[model samples]
Target: MKQSLLEVKGLRVAFGDKEVVHGIDFQIDQGEKLALVGESGSGKTVTALSLLRLAQNADVTGVANFAGEEGGAARDLLALPESKLRGIRGKEIAMIFQEPMTALNALYPVGDQIAEVLELHQALSARAAHEAAVQLLADTGIPEPARRARAFPHQLSGGQRQRAMIAMALACRPRLLLADEPTTALDVTVRAQILDLLTDLQRRYGMAVLLITHDLNLVRRFADRVAVMENGHLIEHGAVATVFDAPRHPYTRKLIDSRPQRDVAPVTARQAEPVLAAKSLRVIYPVPRPGFAGWFRKGEFVAVRGADFRIAPGETLGVVGESGSGKSTLALAALGLLKHQGELDVAGRRWNAGGASDRALRRVMQVVFQDPFSSLSPRMTVEQIVGEGLTVHAPELDAAARRTRSLDVLGQVGLTEAQFPALLDRYPHEFSGGQRQRLAVARALIVDPKLLVLDEPTSALDVTIQKQVLGLLQRLQRERGLSYLLITHDVEVIRAMAHQVIVMKDGAILESGPVGQVLDAPGHPYTQKLVAAALAD
Candidate 1:
């Protein structure tokens, strides 16, 4: 058999006596595709980062051996010097981080950034590097490579940016590629395309890939070998077929079961009164650029065009769409965040799209955003963070009452006051990603808004946490009579929560009906395509 390209043995990582990774071991053979699977805070990402010596402000100890010319070279990757490591980083090893928006340079044009990688590592000239970058873009299946090359990170859609990032990573022709949840932000179709691209590239280049992700389905489809991590421990590792077919670990079994059933039980007509309504909602963003005549030509780019939907009291209305399908635009507009034209009625009270104040609307509706870290303020403590809405809307409550109420809400979201008291004093950085998201949910719920817009609220969480949050949301709705406008691409999540489903494409509604009807017997061809893509195993 061929020698292993990368072998990690007895890998351990610690933070201030808190050991997160406990002597986990794995190997990636030449041209091998390996997956590290686990929930959040599970040493999967740390183990992957350790390969490139990229664990910042953490004590990592591991034996990492890379194949050499004759036999192989075994070295303590953690002890490698900064100078020696620089030569190995991009030239021999490349990484595609989870969040492309955070990983890619937001300020630079996508093509120029790709060109920079080639210029630094490959020693290519300026024009040659640009051409190589374009070719790489084309290779990644990006449409209109020429026009896309000049687009900034923000200008491109989520999937396009991810492809651009992958293009840059492959530009160096590295021996190993570390992909950390590379498809987390993409839709089903885009994910299939990216996975296909990665598999094809790996076959062509014969590069060892260490894929770190929480997506078990993706691991099943792509990985040759699999490793499971939990709370910093490697619980199981084996061939993909063996591990997935008959898992020894209970964690693995739970994950497999968590894979949402493609078909949902039939939906009964919601009996509650309608709590939120949007009539002919339109959100248009103005894009102004100099024309051929050097004059600024303003064009109206319709994001959410004439959207209409209603959410019954204690019901969830799922908005399904691809990236830039205006799902989020509709969510923001519903919350009165964006300048839009629409008739919005919450709890039977008519509200103007532009003139209504957030504080006035707070009593009727609230929003939970996709990213917890960015949505939450890092400066304030959890108490102040959650209570800020209360202080604004219900000014009669004193500081002590607000603190008590905040503690109650936090506890309600599966967090304890004892575990979270420090959170109130410290900033957002002090908490883990899951805990931070729980705090975000607490903030939204403390206000007791009748309507909640869950904008990919569970997108960042692992499956177990997602289920827990979904259950909590159901409970909250049941108790508080809360209505939800749930915007997400997770079809499983839509199946679990949505009473009614709306299929959207190109800023317009393609189909709208009960969730079961849409998922089982989609009328439109586009909806059928989405259903097939989403359910493809």
Candidate 2:
């Protein structure tokens, strides 16, 4: 057996009087990949941060014995002095944090950021570090590394920003790497690429990896060993295949069964009217021309070009694509939020150009955005957030009637005063991600819209919560005959909810057909690649 690289025993983390992480024991073998799996607030992240003493205002205790050099004796990381620990950080053990958009400094160029790490830990000169930074970017499979390194974080794509973060983490060739939800915000193809990069780097560096994530599919494809956490306790630990195939703990079993299940019934043969229809829909933005021609005319960039689709009553038409693919642009055009060149009608009513919004048409169609927390106003209470529509659409209703209507819709979305005391009076931040999403759904349903534009509704939620939300949407569709124009990049979500699917790439629909036809046996090469990427794990 390989020697243990890190052995953690009786690890505890607490903030104030609330103990979030209970004492846990685990170990990592040299060159091995171990995944820590759990939902949000499960204490997996706290455990990882505590090892490096990164958690602020928190009390951490236990023994983290790390073997140093090639054959040197083990040392307790918890008892080390601050100065000594700083030397080991980013040199012997490094971390790749989630959300590279917020993690990377927006002020500095990506190349300069990578060079900073090389200068700090490796003591390389500025000129040497800059060149090495570009090489590191190339090693991570980034295209145009020399040019990309000089670009700011905001100027890069999501995948490119994440690659820059990975390049910085690998600059020092650390012995151990900690990756926290590395691929959560990435598209399916980019997620696969990042996973492959990590595997390759691990083999070249012979570094033991401690991956903290809730994605079971990623663990199945990437990790050798797995540890399951619930609340603050480590409930299960074993080989990935063993724990996944036959989970002993009930919590683990629940997580395994949390994958989205298809419950959508077949469309009836009633020949119902189409809720939404678009023909040759195009959205273009004007950009300033280059230096010589700037004063003459602006350049035109077509965001959504020649898109055509329809959503029938009681049906879901899913738009699947990566970021900047114009899926969101199509959603905005359908909601009458953006100006378009072609025809887009909701409930057979066209949007009035350069005029007041049609009140009746507005009440017939509503939208739910991607992030529920941000979409919902922080200053508004649950009653105000969910019932805001009534003020404009149903102004004749008295205060008592509005309250009753808000409570009714809230109950339909599975939230009630019984489950949450004074539910209508509470704020958005007072609830969990799942609960906030439910509120968003209730707000959309409150207006009794015939069509709902759902933009990445479940992208920001945990697996179990996503499953629940999808199930709720399915139930509402059956009960209320709701039509949905679902936009997202997750293939699993499309398979579980969509009756018909449209594959988008670079502002064009590459393929459109039934979910089984497009996802199971895709005709287009791009569509095939997307399906293959989703199933790669």
- Which one is best on TM-score? 1
All candidates: TM-score: 0.92, 0.86
Question: Candidate 2 — which residues are off by over 4 angstroms?
Answer: 1-3, 54-57, 67-92, 100-168, 269-271, 285-300, 337-339, 352-355, 358-363, 373-406, 425-430
lDDT of 2: 0.88
- Candidate 2 on 6-48: residue-level lDDT in tens? 9999999999899999999999999999999887778888899
CA shift of 271, model 1, Å: 7.7
Per-residue error for 112 in candidate 1, Å, reads 2.9
For model 1, the superposed segments whose C-alpha errors exceed 4 Å read 69-76, 134-148, 260-273, 349-358
**lDDT string, candidate 1, 1-537, tens digits:** 967788788888888888989998788899999998888888788787877778887888878877763465655566789887887787788998876777888889999999999999989998999999999989877777987898899887666788888898888988899998888777787788889988888898888889988788899899999988888998989999999999999998987677543322232435555777889988998765556633646777898878888887667899988876888888877876788887877776766533435457766788887778778877788888999999888899999999899888888888885665565676777776677788888899898888889988887777777777788787777777677899988888898888899988889999999888998899999898888988883
lDDT of each: 0.82, 0.88
Error of 2 at 265 (Å): 2.6
Clash counts per candidate, in order, are 0, 0
